[model samples]
Target: MKQRLSLIIGIFIVMALSNAIVPVLPEYASEMPALQGIIFSAYFFGAFVMVIPAGVLGDRYGRAPFITAGLLLTLLSGGIILLAANPYAITFARIVEGIGAGLFVSCALSWVNMQPDHTRLSGLYFAGLNAGLIAGLMGTGILNSHFGQNSGVMLFTGLAVIPLLLSFFIRDTTGVLTNVLPPVHAIGWRNKWLYFSSFILVGISGVLVSLYPEFTDESPFILGLLFAAMNGATICASLIAPNISLQPIQTIRLASALVGIAVLLSFIAPAYGGIGGVFVLFMVIGGSIGFVFVSQMNYLAVSEKLQGTAIGLLTAASYGGMAMLPFFSGLLTEVFSYGAAFLVNGILCLLVTVTIARCRCALPE
Candidate 1:
């Protein structure tokens, strides 16, 4: 129970602190439109590079050390972000923070997948993730609005200490396995569909999140609430998705399609439906994302020997898409309209869905 609690809190802190700056991105880097995407994606880039290594090493060594080290890195990154003198410095700090998150999340997820009731536990774990995301968006937006720009940074930075301290008491469960694990490349190829699906599904969420602050005309506080609505729906869906009777592949297909349609519809929401329409569409997108996430994780947890490598690769794919998609979409926004960029995102989801459907690889039940 303590281990579970620690993982939950650790994920929550990492997610919250990482996301707190999202709502304020436009104000944070007002003059650097071209660089905004880079700033937003830097963390994902760092995380993308680290997760696979962390996962592979954790399987051999111990996940507990990596988790502890990750928390410490997270703590350090927050301070760096707070004191960063320029956009470059802030971007560098974000990358450092992302590395910490990748280490903690990949290993923690591997640990969860090794457990007996991973489906239910993973649901709760993802719930913590979305909850932290909501807190970050809403809390930071309100705090920054009421106090100052640095207020939210200060608050979340201080809160990061809790999980770091908690890491000391959490147990490590590394035991030598005589059965040799498959090579990382082989493990990744075996689960290519899962990784690809996770990449596109989570990447869609990233596109909305990374670009929305600049896309919307609302105040920072209101923007936070809007983003919160999306994440709030994600929390609800994560908890409920595991109980659904559909197979993992079926759920992924439906959810991915739903998220695509929702994103496409969002182009017209603000103009025709107003803030309420946009809010509902965002919720749909979030809910769909939650469904896809849970389904993919469930599929990946099928093999105990492949747990760390598969989860790590899954995470790396997700972060890679998050990093690349938004950065490219931002460039599209500069050349075209936000609507055009969003339309492209919707199309990309549909393409990935079609590709997955045609793939011959069967999903684990």
Candidate 2:
């Protein structure tokens, strides 16, 4: 078995760095609600752009180099953000950081799917991923209080070194390289619905994190706990879902339904259910997102020849969803009530469920 500790550490740091600014978005963008959405989506946009290319190139060259390069970029982006004089610089830094994340994630996941005991390892990988999100959310909130707006970014940037070093030790899982393009029709086109599932399912959480800071008047620390609660549930679900007997498709369907219901309920949770209700709703959303990720990965398995490309495409869709949905959701927030925004998102979830149920081809056996 490959010593995957390095991969875990690398992913954790990358995820934490990706989200370190979430809790302080309002202050970071200060008075410009529109810029907050732009700043938040910038990373996802970078990731979306980089993932497919990284995946394709990784197949031809190697996954290990991209992983190392990604960490390096992460470190560089952190420095940029730390010294940034204005919002434009910060946004640019975020895009660089996101590009790093897209490279690491697609390649890292392709590496994981190739290993023995992949199901178990995938669970562990996702657990670390969500744990990093929680740490970034909570830690940044705490640090922001004591230090300043960039404090969390500084701390996470410093923490990124451990992974950058660790990534060097990861041996390439794909032993052979080919110059031929992966069969996009087989890996991506035929499975478009599943990819769309990735888009709609995981995206629900992205919408929350992007909008929540402005949605509530809670302090950064309290907001951190709230976001952390959701991610904590995500970690738990990722760890446990792989152990269950359900088929990957079955698990995805169930989780998607729950996510849809939870999003609908979130609108009322703030009023009738109070803060506690909101917390519970967040957990429901988080857990469903976790299940969707694990099941989606397990279900999307392809031959070694197409593994990197397949994982890359799936990741691109996921990040694409994360990037576009929240920005659109924020737009909806501008034009309509928050309740209306949630309603539309919730309906999208159910629509995804229907699409999945209707999808007859390219499903895992």
Candidate 3:
């Protein structure tokens, strides 16, 4: 495989494992129903706290080394999950996993962006990340259906190994040994508007995914399947996005509209249309995933000091959303029903779209 491809594959292993791991928390918590939300949030809590520091470390130490360390942690975490039965044990395992995820994404994306763009190979990295996410979720869900919860952890254990092996194939980038280096202290996060909006966008996506299971009690596996489909569509969107002359913000606006309309439709016809509506929901979800990632990173890539914090905050934003969503959405559902949850997310997402449309310039050529 090509060098970037190998790197992305390693990155994908981490991505998919992390994405798949979250949806399993609810099922795991069934053994102690009182602690579902707390257990679910534990991993993200770790991630939320670690992202900034991890980003700084990755930038200073080099992305590859951090990614290697994180993937190793993921390997260990998966093993712990396979043996864990207690809520406390499971929570600790997930926290380890979260830290691994935070380390992987921030470092991996920085490395990947260095790859030559406007070529077919450039799109592969994004697809690899999203596909890994989709695959992990979908694969885990299907495995859970066939093997049950304990086996689910083992299944991830096997999946986690692919990245570990792939990491070996990843030759260190030249930047890792470069003579010229930016003075780490020279970079600043003064560009508040760009980074903050990007973080919020990440937060909204996390909230939706974290709270999504409550919207449908079908199967925890369904969360994986639905997210898989969503990520599949996200991969497709990334490939097609550059073909159109639309500005990145314009692309985000259009994608947000589709997502809003899809969420609205999914809410109205959630169960009426059966699996088909579930698929549509994911497709819309996927588009939002593509737009948010591509657009936000595009903005942050231009920044210097903000780069590390931007990446760290970007990772933390999702974890923060994860930490808050279970409590907030759970409370909302208690008072207003799950359909209301969809409505609330839809409205907020649309509002962001409107704001972006009103202010930002089109994506640069």
Candidate 4:
């Protein structure tokens, strides 16, 4: 119980510091706006590069060391951002942060899977993630507005120390290192539908992270509130996910539908109800994502022996979508408009939903 508490707190703090900078990053890089997408996606890029290796290493050795290393990297990234004077430096810092996030998440999740009662525990794990994002979005927004970007960056960086310290206390559970690798079939590579659903869910989130700032000319506080509404809804959904029983395919289909509707609504709400409509849609999107995320985690947590590898692949796919899709969405926005990009996302979500449903029918039950 003590270990679980520390892990939860550690993950919450790590995610909070990681996400706190998102809403303010564009403002920090205003001089070269074209690179904003690169900077935003850099973190995920780093995570994508290292997540698989991190998972493999954690499974062989122990998760504790990697968790500590990840926290240290996160602390270093925060410091770099605090002192960075150019977009290049910030991008490097973001990549470093992403690596830290990947290491921490893959290991921490694998650690959680070791515990029993996964349905409830997965909810708690996701709740920590969403809660941290909400804190970061709202807290950083307020701090950035009041103390300027540099100070806000410094403050958030300082907060990383707490998690870094806590990570040292995480119990090492790497027991009986295995020389043999599991069969390829055991890794669930055939579950392409699961991976695709993860990709679409995070792809939409990445687009929102990159483009939502431009949606309204509101103050940072208002913008923060809007993001908070979305993340808050995500927290609620995650906490309730365990109680909402549904088959894996059913959950994916429902989540995909919600995301598609939300994306389509993004185009309409602002036109009719202004920012309020957009805010409502964001909440819907967040809830749907939370549901999808927990459902996937539950599916992967099924095997004690293969859980690490399964989750590693899932993390890689999810972050890959996050890294690439938002950059593409940014290009679309440059060529066309935000609405055009969102419409494309909505269409893609619908298509993916159909594909997953078909895959479900073909896969064994």
Q: What digit string (tens of lDDT, one per residue) describes model 2 on residues 84-175?
A: 87889989999999899988888888888877677778889999998988777777877888998889999989988887887778888644
Best by lDDT: 2
Q: What are the per-residue Cα lDDT tens digits for candidate 4 across 56-128?
A: 7777777889888888898899899887888899899989999998898888887777666767887888888
Better of 2 and 4 by TM-score: 2
lDDT of each: 0.81, 0.82, 0.64, 0.77
> What TM-score does structure 3 among the candidates reach?
0.80
Best by TM-score: 2
> Which pairs in model 3 have colliding backbones?
187-305, 188-305, 247-363, 248-363
Our tally of clashes for model 4 stands at 0
Deviation from native of the Cα of residue 110 in model 4, angstroms:
1.2
RMSD of each: 2.7, 2.3, 3.9, 2.9
Off by over 4 Å in 3: 19-27, 118-122, 144-148, 168-225, 242-246, 271-278, 302-306, 357-363
Q: What lDDT would candidate 2 get against the real structure?
A: 0.82
User: For candidate 3, which ten residues in a row score worst on lDDT?
Assistant: 185-194
Deviating ranges (above 4 Å) for candidate 4: 23-30, 172-177, 181-188, 215-219, 358-365
CA-RMSD of model 1: 2.7
